[model samples]
Target: MRFGMGQQRITRAECAHVAALARLELTDEELDRFTGQLDELLDHVAEVEALDLEALPPTMHALPIANLLRPDTPGEVLDRDEVLAQAPFAEDGQFRVPPVLGEAP
Candidate 1:
């Protein structure tokens, strides 16, 4: 299907080729549907490209952004013994977890 007045059109064969490269198995109906959808998307892109955006400043986001992180400051450290006592399993003054990779402890 054609896109807008002079925009390029997406063909079913091209869509099929893309699907093959992506290891997709689309039916004939799906190919037709996707081709039309892609054509519409390209038309929208063309319209956007035709807009007068020279005066507008380029921006990553629509709204103003600011860092929300708090200041990093030194904090009180917890006692190792107290923290180990709260754990379900502790060994040699450390928290003990089950073997993950079948390695001998």
Candidate 2:
């Protein structure tokens, strides 16, 4: 029965109705729990709505961001034998990996 000014409180019966509409079966305890949870969510929404955010600029992120990418440049490749020597497993001049699609019979 508690609600802030202009805040419409959600009732247990309304919660039951919504559950029925969604084809959800809930026990009395679950219905009671959800009714309280829904009220808290609605109260939070109302609190946010009361805030004056029009003076602030809209932004996708909190801080300024810029691309830090560097131009791609060609570099000398490592010798295949040298690279493969560091690998735990290799076959036919390539890194060997476990079968991912399926296991061999």
Candidate 3:
């Protein structure tokens, strides 16, 4: 699903049509580029169409992973009063910031 699905050999004319639909005016170099690209893409599609999918189990995740955990521990807290003392504007127990906007018209 992430890659190729259907099988179809791409042609230069189809590349031209796609370029026209995308509003692209391709030069000879660009047209050749797109032609090769489309051909390769279709070749990939043909490859995917040849897959044998009779035994693979479909799953939500690719593989299982585990994590080791440790118990929570309290740590030393910052001195709020000391921090606020260095603030440009501090009121009551919290640091005050400037208003973003003036009164609306």
TM-score of each: 0.67, 0.60, 0.61
- Clash number for each model: 0, 0, 0
What TM-score does candidate 2 reach? 0.60
Better of 1 and 2 by lDDT: 2
RMSD of each: 3.7, 4.8, 5.8
lDDT of each: 0.85, 0.87, 0.78
Q: What is the lDDT of candidate 2?
A: 0.87
Off by over 4 Å in 1: 1-8, 74-80, 89-105
Residue 94, candidate 1: Cα error in Å is: 4.7
* lDDT tens readout by residue for model 3, 75-95: 898899999999988998998
lDDT of 2 by residue, 12-81 (tens): 9999999999999999999999998888888887779889999999999899989889879988999999
Number of the top-ranking candidate, with lDDT as the measure: 2
Distance from true location, Cα of 17 in model 2, Å: 2.5
Sort by lDDT, best first: 2, 1, 3
Arranged by TM-score with the best first, the candidates are 1, 3, 2
lDDT of 1: 0.85
Give the lDDT of residue 53 in candidate 2: 98
lDDT of 1 by residue, 1-105 (tens): 325675557778988998899999999999889888887887887779889999999999999989989889989999999999999889999999879997555
The predicted structure with the larger TM-score, 2 or 3, is: 3
Q: List the residue pairs that clash in candidate 2.
A: none
Report how far residue 63 has shifted in candidate 1, in Å. Answer: 1.8
Which regions in candidate 3 have their CA more than 4 angstroms from the true location?
1-8, 65-76, 102-105
